[model samples]
Target: MTMKDPKSYDLLSYIVVFLGFYEGVLPFVAKSTDWEPFLSLPRHLSSPAWWIVSGLVIVASFFSLWGIDIAKKRRHPDA
Candidate 1:
């Protein structure tokens, strides 16, 4: 967790949090009821909306990772 190392997970977080939520919730939701954990874009969703949404999601993800890195640095300054 050193400042130099900036210990932070990347792809692992994405798979575990995002995809895991999708997998766990989607199945149970459908089985219990007709609920959906999430949904894809509308068939007619505009390209600008798609790009803006995607860009924001990507930027937010990067910020999350960056914050984790900063936290690790604070937690274990000499790591």
Candidate 2:
């Protein structure tokens, strides 16, 4: 397989990580603390749709980080 640019993966991973944090972690914290969320989101945290979307974002972030690791390994097998 043609190796992808690790920098691209790095950038994508960072973005996904931020999204995961924003969607998954931030909402619960904001709701508990009575602080306004940074992004406008569904007010009902108990909604199944909200949980599903947040879970997907968190999973995607994990995969993105994993992709970066795999790309780095492909670039430097000896390291």
Candidate 3:
């Protein structure tokens, strides 16, 4: 079977990583500072829905990175 070019999706994978990182870290930053605009965000951060969605996005990003790595290795076995 032929494999799709992994390079084509590198940008997408990186974007997911960024988003996951942002989602996971934003709440912590919001809570630790007195940033006026983020005051309300800290409240929602305590909800179960917030944790679930953040966890899902972070997990998805991890899997996406792993898949890309496997694809690249399969495309270049000797490397």
Candidate 4:
């Protein structure tokens, strides 16, 4: 029940990490007079705590693809 090594999963991992990093930083860089809370919420949600959760999510997402690859490999070991 191990995972398979698929290039697509790696690319997706990079994309998700990039998106999470963007979400984590955009709020801080945003400017406004009274839009404080909304902007800050994502920053908060993107905190170390949430980052840990999101990191797990990215790993799980990678595993999901890995699982698919594993199944495919089981079906066609030559591939």
Candidate 5:
């Protein structure tokens, strides 16, 4: 049996990408200085853990979009 690549990416994947972009930028633009490293996101952009989380989400979203394009190309090479 030949496995098929999905013709389209799911809605949740798009949502993640949006949320990820927000999560990644929120901390950087936050004006508040009193934020807990682990509890507060908008104020903890300086935290290494936060950076890692943000980077992961952003990269994941980007790759998700890229994968969607690849899948579409494979399914419809003429398009």
Candidate 6:
């Protein structure tokens, strides 16, 4: 089967990575600092919904990277 655009996958991987970092960091920052809106975020992060979201982010990142790898392999099979 043919792969989709590698650049698109690469961009998506970058975005997912950024989001994963944001999700993981927000609660820590919220707890450690005095930001008003951020302070409440940490409390909600303990919920199952946040966990699921984080999991999905991780999965998306993994898949995107995998796709990129496949595309690179297809592009340079001899490497």
Task: List per-candidate RMSD values in Å.
Answer: 9.1, 3.7, 4.8, 7.9, 5.3, 5.2
Which lDDT tens digits does candidate 4 get at residues 13-70? 5665565445544444542232344533444563466555545555665666576566
Model 2 spans > 4 angstroms off: 1-8, 40-46, 76-79
| lDDT tens digits by residue: candidate 2, 31-76 | 6787877473633556677667666766777887787778777886
Clashes of 3: 0
Counted clashes in each candidate structure: 0, 0, 0, 0, 0, 0
Which digits, one per residue and each the tens of the lDDT, describe model 5 over residues 19-72?
A: 766776555544345433453353454567766876676677688778766766
Q: Answer with 2 or 4, whichever has the higher lDDT.
A: 2
lDDT of 3 by residue, 1-79 (tens): 2345555556656776777677655554554684433433332655676666666766877888898777777876654
Best by TM-score: 2
User: For this target, which candidate reaches the highest lDDT against the unseen true structure?
Assistant: 2
Give the C-alpha miss distance for residue 68 in model 1, angstroms.
Answer: 0.6
Would you give me the overall lDDT of model 6?
0.58
lDDT at 53, model 5: 72
Residues 1-79, model 6: lDDT tens digits? 3335556545666776776556645544554584535433333665676656655655666776787677767875654
Candidate 5 residue pairs in clash (backbone atoms < 3 Å): none
Task: Show the lowest summed lDDT stretch of 10 residues, model 4.
Answer: 31-40
- In angstroms, give how far residue 71 of model 1 lies from its true place: 0.4
TM-score of every candidate: 0.44, 0.62, 0.58, 0.38, 0.52, 0.47
> Local error of candidate 6 at 76, Å?
3.1
- List the global CA lDDT of all models: 0.48, 0.68, 0.62, 0.52, 0.58, 0.58
Global lDDT for candidate 2? 0.68
Tell how far residue 44 is off in model 4, in angstroms: 6.9
Candidate 4: stretches off by over 4 Å: 1-46, 77-79
